[model samples]
Target: MSSKLSDYDYPLPEALIAKRPLPRRDASRMMVLHRDSQTIEHRQFRDLKTFLRPGDLLVLNNTRVLAARRFSDDHGIEFLFLEKLGPARWKCLVKPGRKMRLSATAKIDNVPMHVEEILPDGERIVALAEDVDLYAHGSMPLPPYIGRESDPADDERYQTVFAQTPGALAAPTAGLHFTTEILSEIPHVFVTLHVGPGTFRPVHSETLAEHPMHAESFSISKEAAAKIDNAQRIVAVGT
Candidate 1:
């Protein structure tokens, strides 16, 4: 049978959605699923090391989140940058996506932008009028479920300890539970996967098969690939 969009939907209590990180990076709750036995266990995030074997191979995604969200003009229409098309040109997702017409011009935090093209996937190609300090005025493009505006703390805690590249619109959330102390005990390989905002996009289509999955760029180093290839078990850190 085909899966319906409703089949994948579940009710999440609003209170359960964390507006901010826990006081400690490793203080979150963890659920362990045992597929073979059909058993489940609940534990603290810091207890993860207890379940892993000495020879287990752990792989981490090290893509960093960018301050990609900016207001389009003073009215506060939002543009979440997805990727760089070229120097001073970016592909972005405009909120109220229908409001942006072809050949329209908008200012993002005082940086003038020209709408060059609209892709079939609903992303807009925009050309900047001048170089702007995006980080100075832009905030992290957090997921909708966060239910709060980005604060100063997000600039640091929203990123993982291993993040190195600054392209992801969203954080590799699975890695968010790790701290430097916890990470030091684990032997791991690093890979890059620039997460896009589409990760949180809902499947509006009736069936799951009809919903298109958004693509994100990722790369694995030769050293990381070799380690993964030789490992007895692979533990992926995040989506």
Candidate 2:
């Protein structure tokens, strides 16, 4: 039977939603839904180590979050990097869309950034000031749901220890639960998928199939793909 979007809807109490990270990354609870037994197993996240074998592969997205928040004397602007179109060009979403003009300049922490062009949906193609590394100047692009300003600790906690790519605007939350100790116990490979704001967009369609998945730019090197192909099983952590 084809499932509609409403069919997949489940009630989640506001209290159940995690608002902050646990004292430890692996301290969160885990719920394993078993279809055959029609049962749910309540377990701690750390117990995940017990369920895997040595050769199993865990594929994770390692795209680091870019601090895309910008402020000025009179206005505050926020942006999320969508994709890297060229060495210095990126498709990005800008806030206060009505106030920002095409081919204008926005100062990020006193750094002059020129908006080369604008897209249909408040997106802009911007160029950073010369001799500046955009990644270094950018802050961790926190989700709007966070409802708070980004903190210094977010610079490290928001990224994986192995994160090498600097493009995603948001961290893959599921992967945030993992620790080096847990990763060391399991064989894993990292991949890059520069997640955009679309991932957090509300589902407006009536049918699940009618809801299109965002097209993300992902790269899996031959070596990583070979490792995944050779593994006994593949475990995907997050959506």
Model 2's C-alpha root-mean-square deviation from the true structure amounts to 2.9
Index of the highest-TM-score prediction: 1
TM-score of each: 0.92, 0.82
lDDT of 2 at 51: 74
> What lDDT score is found at residue 45 in candidate 1?
95
State the lDDT of candidate 1 residue by residue for 1-239, as single tens digits.
64876766688899888787889989899999989999999999999999999778889999988888878777656888777767788888887776776787888766788889999888899889876555566788778888888887888998998899888988898999998898889888999999876786877889888888888889999999999999888999975
Lowest summed lDDT across 10 adjacent residues in model 2 is found at: 129-138
Q: RMSD in angstroms, all models?
A: 1.9, 2.9
**Candidate 1 wrongly placed segments (more than 4 Å):** 133-136
Worst 10 residues of 1 by lDDT: 129-138
